[model samples]
Target: MTGIEAINVYCGLARLPVPALFAGRGLDPARLDHLMMTERSVGLPCEDPVSNAVNAARPVVDALSPEERDSIELLVTSSESGIDYSKSIASYVHAYLGLGRNCRVMEVKQACYAATGVLQLAAGYLASGVSPGARALVIATDVSMADARAGYAEPATGHGAAALLIGPDARVLELDPGAFGLYSYETLDSARPEPDRDIADVDASLFAYLDCLSRSFADYRSRVADADWHTTFTRLALHTPFAGLVKAGHRKLTRELTGAGPDAVAADFAERVAPSLHYPSRVGNLCSGSVYLALCSLIDHLPPGAPPQRIGLFSYGSGCASEFFSGLVGEGARQALAPARIGERLAARVPIGFDEYTDLLAGNSRCLLPVADRDIDLAPYERFLTADPGRGRLLVHRGTKNYHRTYEWV
Candidate 1:
């Protein structure tokens, strides 16, 4: 029964409130409010995905004693925002965190489902009896971006990262070894051929998402035939592109599983799934990290002395792939999460105006330095793109002439 030992998350430090973002974009404020509510905010382009991943995994590494850090046998990063085509972001993350050199490091991609896939693989490795006492570090990091043409999805875009320390102790949710279901197929629902631009066919994508949900949940029920799904699992953690879709997914699940009407479905959702949506509501969508963030939110909001819980997780990625799995939450799960700490971090973010957000987006260089002039001032362009000599971490990608990337720690 491999399970989560410790988990940590980091959202981008800059934000753009929903109202301000859509104020002059010709969107109907009242209609948008009716749909998404007023509390949503998207991550501003303040940091690259690598930095977010590094910052997210830092605390988990810091919590470990030197000996525990050395016991980490695998480091896997799942993201759509890989900085280099040839090098895995896991290597940069390993170097940044100063993890043990003996650890195996790699990156996985299958749209947003990448994290869920890598996590299951890590769990399997730990359960394989290869390293009796070792731990695996899994990271999900993404910074969602939409071009001016992306319309509604531009508002749903978000950026963040979550890091999970997987081991056998299971202070958090203890995963059931054989209880999982997966469904996948080829589809062009969403794509990003350019580094900074993302495009999706909204209607097709939504239809595909719900279809995957139905198929995966049906497979899960088939696998665990004797269990009473509706009553057995007290909570759900669904991948969220927007708050509304998650609610819709829950209602759809209720209808399929129990023949419940809207009233009953709404009641079930309020009691079980709403508590886990806090982060998603606040941060919009965090590509690979979305579902795990929901899990963190669920653990953070549980009532004191609540009995042990069974949590059902649904993960979806846009190529598209989906999985349904369940885990048992132990008594120590609440204490292990420390929800207030995460709340404080979220509350401390600096909000930027829409004008500033557009400027930042326009100035994003994707770390591709200008070929002719190396002396350009990137500070006014994108603060995160600037190379600060004083900072210990710097990533520079010299163009095709050199085909070299240098990571410097001063």
Candidate 2:
């Protein structure tokens, strides 16, 4: 019996809604813009991607007082980029948030699918009754490919993060121990860059990636069938790759599941999914955070007094690892969501000019640049400059950075 036997997601942030930025700094109109024109690859809009990720998570953490953050048994941060391989993102986040040192910090690696894997692992521990009353903290965030010259290189790759505080509660989604599936294929043919490397050739574009996901689903469906599981999964929270990849995979999978005939399950699942794309279009692809973002988006729109919902999740990581899992969205999902407030925050962003975006991009993590004690009202906790770069160390800044920069929950 795990400490917290169920999982309930907090808020999910997709894009930095910079209406001002979008209006002022027109994005490259080309289907995909390679070779960024900005003096620096980093832009203010780019900053918002990460900032918004942290921003989207603020409310969830705020709902829990400092006491809860400190008590989490494990803090798992799954992402492609770590500030430095030697440093732990979980540790950095913990220090920034003033979480207790007692927290077990670890990062997962598996491309976009890493976050789901981490959640599954935590669920297993909980199911075993290992830490009967303990909980796990899972946060997934990713910024754009650092290279400004690549097929996937539009400022389109926005930054963001999603945090889910998992614990036992009869009110939330109950843990389905044997329900989820795990699968992977190994090869570096389509790998994202290592910290020392740059973006690699898109031997497989986003379209090709979707095709891989389709193939994975077909493969997994057969396994489920072989096991004599005849259950039907209705809704799905897909990993947003580019956009609409889910629909593409869904079409192919439903066709396979229903024998290529027009049917209610296939048609209804397609129509019901319109709202899931709301954040993906704006946020672009958040690497690991995509699946949870889609899940959170669905939770926001679900009607009151709705019956329990079963969702199938498809997670794929290039260098190719993919997995599918299922869950029941519990009855108490509504109150725990606080959905409307999150929608309001997403709507309030000011767009940035392309020029300003360039400026922000160039200045990201500027060691020599002066910074003042600015009030980051959207974040939940305090942020402070801990040390000066001159101390013979690679300059670093750290704080309890959650979904956003500060707390405006009051």
- In terms of lDDT, the best-performing candidate is 1
Error of 2 at 129 (Å): 0.9
lDDT of 2 by residue, 259-321 (tens): 555575456555556456665555556678777767766766677887886666778787777
The sequence of per-residue lDDT tens digits that candidate 1 reaches over residues 269-288 is 88999988888777777787
Every candidate's lDDT? 0.76, 0.53
Which residue pairs clash within candidate 1?
Answer: none
Runs of candidate 1 with Cα error greater than 4 angstroms are 30-46, 365-410
Q: In candidate 1, residue 329 scores what lDDT?
A: 87
Rate residue 267 of model 2 by lDDT. 62
Q: Estimate the Cα RMSD of every predicted model relative to the unseen true structure.
A: 3.9, 8.2
Cα deviation at 403, candidate 2, in Å, is 24
Model 2 poorest 10 in a row by lDDT? 386-395
Which candidate should be chosen as best, given TM-score against the real structure?
A: 1
Q: Among all windows of ten consecutive residues in candidate 1, which has the lowest summed lDDT?
A: 390-399
